[model samples]
Target: TVKPPVETVEVSPPETPLIPPEKERAPSEKVTPPLEVEERKEVEKQKEEEIEVEVSREEKEEEGKGELKRRPEEALERKAPERRFSIKTIFSPLTTITESIRKRKRRTTALEEVGPPLVKPKRVPRTLKEELPPADWRVLKEYEVRGGVAMIRIYLDPETSNYIYWVIEPPLSDVEKDNLKRLKDLLQVSLPYSLEAVEEERREKFLLEHLDKVMEDYRIKMSENSLEKVRYYIVRDFLGFNKIDPIMHDPHVEDISCDGPGIPIYLYHRDYGSIKTNVAFPTDEELDGFVVSLAQKCRKTISVANPILDATLPNGSRLNATYGREVTTRGSSFTIRKFREEPLTVVDLVENNTMSADMAAHFWLAVQYGESMIFAGGTASGKTSTMNAISIFIPPSSKIISIEDTREVNLPHENWIAGITRGGAEAERPGDIGMYDLLRAALRQRPEYVIVGEVRGKETMTMFQAMATGHTTYSTMHADSVKSIVYRLENPPIGIPRVLIQALNLVAIHKQLKVKEKRVRRITELVEIIDIEPTTLEIVTNQVFRWNPRTDTFVYGGHSNLYEKIMDMEDLSRDEVLEERDRRAEIISWMVKNGVRKFWDVARVVGEYYEDPHRTLSIIEKNPEVEGNPLEVFERAAEKGRKEHLKAKSVAA
Candidate 1:
């Protein structure tokens, strides 16, 4: 509050009327009385009243000496006798100036005890909220990423409406930046010329040697509050994804891209859709330098001759970048398809309308029984993510191996071996580990399930052969339709003789579509391969499930050739297999309802269910957060089995 400026009574000083100048003055001017007789009498009366009030105050002070000794507060509340003569002089506003000063100090201390001023104060950093706030910046949400939590925000630009942004908290300090530069120089000095060409995996080993000392030196230079920031930025810039690392960690960001220098970084946001960001590469030279650094991190290099680069980040994000203006007029550019650290589970897909619960339940049944499936989709159609999510349906104890050009498949199974194809000068050499090489090696490993990240070339044949050998295969191919999938398989480079192609049982066509103006990827069609004509090599297919674009719903043909194949393989009656599927579906529904979305949590539930179904059901059934019957799977199954038993008994009678 603006304090009233030292409250004081208005006092009129006695005015002096000017006499006429000597030249103009008449003899009568000297004789005239100054200020009139009435004014003089009034002034005299005011003086007398003031004198009387002072005398009264003196008398009261003498009488209250005993009270003042007992209670100091009482003196502040005391009223003086000068109500009419309330003019305040510096000497005596009310008795001693010292007493007045004490009272003012006490009131000021009380005002401060409550809170700061009501008006917007200067920016100040607090433990939680910031002291200083710019007019525009507003944080929309905060979420944890790999190394640190990130803040996602939106703000109106002068021209544009709003732009989405991702920034990590505990921002890096200047000293840390200096430390990072020093560390990078030190790293280059320590490595041999040959070792410098090594891939990201090996570079990590090289950097690890001096990381402790580097961190200690950085830590010593930073303030106590800045220690965490130092660590975060160090990991983020050097060990993590660098400038893009903040957005890469955001689970909501599906894609992170920088078009070129002077262009803002754009992120495809899960909630708000695509939005331009504040992050930008300031110049071509600077961007090229960063891209070169990114290449080295990926264990690759970019130059005028090798201007294009494609690689995977340590976190599994796909990086497609270009160096210099040789490729195009625009400066260096990069697009990163950020991979979620915790790959989505079946619950995530069902909730997202990418596929229905019934579809997931079917996948669960088929996958568990070792039925091979091929997920085909256009680019950015969520082929790999769906493949990863459904892989959770595989029994936890099963040994699984995943092969890819980039390591994208995330499995919960402990016995899983993830493989990525090698690149650079040694790629075609005998020591090279390509996708086909990895697949051949994986077969020897005798894995129960083999996952191929993507098949675009010669590796496609090996993947199908792996499936033909009774290895339950999970792989993705870039094909929009089942017919297209066959063509790609039978065509050159991927040349699987049409006969060997029939080994692939199911073809799930996943695609992105606009529903109600919003983009969503759904299983547009699911086809079961029944036969390949012996004479004509004509592929026969059973269209089991398809998405109805008009209704934005999945059409599941309840009967599947694959499921029938499952019946023959598992040696179980149809009802028993169906019951198992329903039970798994129920477990998934329970988890989705209870907010168990994390991959680890979903994996735990599936593993626990495998160990003890009833115990898992009981755990869910007892959870108060789960509404209705969490044990519906068991209850309904028991009822169905009991009815079947009664029918059998009646037949015997």
Candidate 2:
């Protein structure tokens, strides 16, 4: 039968196209819209030859019974073009369909949908064992089950908090303990070396080397529970600390302390102050073994004769342990003050509201101009972090010499000399280099800046002498307030003449506070030392900044004495110095706005700023994506610098 001419359908273009706004438009200008517009024209031209198709009643019925994943081809043609389908690309889905003569196959078939509603193969959940830490703690990873109780690691979740706490694992059942003993014996012959002898690099390799063979040989017929316990035991013993590996990985834990056996482990969390964990040793023997293993990892011997042990771990965390209750009264115990490889930056301090942008700006001016500053605070008050953050302001080219009991100060400057003190029984030869020795050596190196980790003993005298000779000194001291700083310096052991105290120009006291349940660290007092009072022998201090707890803000203490001193030394006016301060502040503010908080990244930016201040500042000024004052941050800083420059020239006349 002859059919009257078939009519083609004209499709409309979407209101919005799929192409990027500028990249597609920039080249041809009119090329983007033509695809949508021309496709309609092409379809309408072929309308006289177009043919329509029909579906059978049986097929339609089957499709209706099951859920349809895709719409009809006509509907697909309508929606697909609006999204990803680019008309120009010859290989596009729409292009393939429109170009082909054969009928398109349906994505979902009727037989396929009806054939046993597909069982979604269940996802194998992560076996709920503890996470394997990246470090090795092999001192006593493997154990034989002599008693009924076997230590099984279980992950704990505090019902009130989102944090997953790994507590002292609950004891295993009698049957489970027997399984662990059998598993240990099966794997015992294969182990090449003890945990202590296995190097850090070889620990992971050793565990993994034997893992597959052990599983294939022993894990084939084992139950999931028995298999899981064996795996946890293997990992806990080889790769991580039996009970505290999870705590070792926790970034929030500042300090981890174990007070002998049978007592709860205490942790000084950065935000929570002191939190007693659920993990503790059941026996003194177990505790002693762990402590000895830890000491071996630190490469130190802890004995009854040498009960007081202080050493550094492989990861650079500080370790202090006391054995035999000779001094600590508790059995062998340890307290590790976790070390941060990456130091805190100025941006971190500002974003946390520890210090204001202006106060930080003032600090920048002071640091650049060789101001001797000291961070004073109580224990765990963020004094070192504050000092480390602020030290970034020191000219990147300046030669810095850092002396510490144990290596701590990490600087980005290439011109840095690090000196660490060594003593105790190890100094039996009478030639162990102490902090005093390092300080004296640092001076002969002719460093522009001297950083003492902390001034405790005779080293205090040497540090003060360095400060007196125009070397910009930065140190941390254990003191509550600015007055206490003078007292500590003038007293015996540290015994500095009261007249020499004026050498210290800045004392920034950081404090740990509890505003509402949460622990916050902030600088409560920032003082500028005017001079030592000749008449009273008391320190003449001008309060430059004080933290306001009520508003959670920093109140600027008038203008700035340190800033004035900087201007005088640099031979610039008040306005010029203010401009310089603002300029430095804006650079820091820009960094905070962006996420340049890492020590190396922050140092890189600071180094670039030193190379070309205007270029660096302009790059920040032009980027609209970065958040800050924008007009105020740049214009005010630039204007102030220019004005100050003019004032300096006018005064020069």
Winner by TM-score = 2
**Candidate 1: what lDDT?**
0.67
Worst 10 residues of 1 by lDDT: 105-114
> Which parts of model 1 are misplaced by more than 4 Å?
1-150, 156-242, 424-431, 533-537, 569-576, 612-653
What are the TM-scores, per candidate, against the unseen true structure?
0.64, 0.67
lDDT of 1 by residue, 1-653 (tens): 11122222222221222333463455333322222223334545544332211111111333321111112222122123222212132213334433433333211000001122344433322311222224565556556666435555554344455654645356555656555554454343433454446685775565554554544532325465555555555556656666676676677789878878767788888766788775666667678888998888777888998898879876677888999898867778888888777788888888888887777888877787777899999988988888999898788878988887876888878888888888721156666678877888889999999988877777777778788888999888888998888888878877878889888888889888788877788998888889977788799889888899989898877778866776788787878877876777777777777677788777767776776677566666656365454345444544565567689989999
lDDT per model, in order?
A: 0.67, 0.67
lDDT of 2 by residue, 1-653 (tens): 11122332232333344355574444323232333334444544544222232211111343332121323332212213122221111122443433431332112111112122234432323322323522332222222221312332222234443222234343466666655654454455446567567777877667766765655643334566665666666766656666776577666678999987777677876654676665677566778778887888777788888887777787878889888678878677889888886767888899988898888888877788788989999998888888878888778778988887766677888898887777631244376777777788889998998998888787888787788999999999999998788888889778988777788889999888887777888999899888867788667789988988888898877767876776678899988877877888888887787777889777777776776688567767776344554434444545566677689989999
Q: Report each candidate's C-alpha RMSD, comma-separated, in the order given.
A: 21.5, 26.5
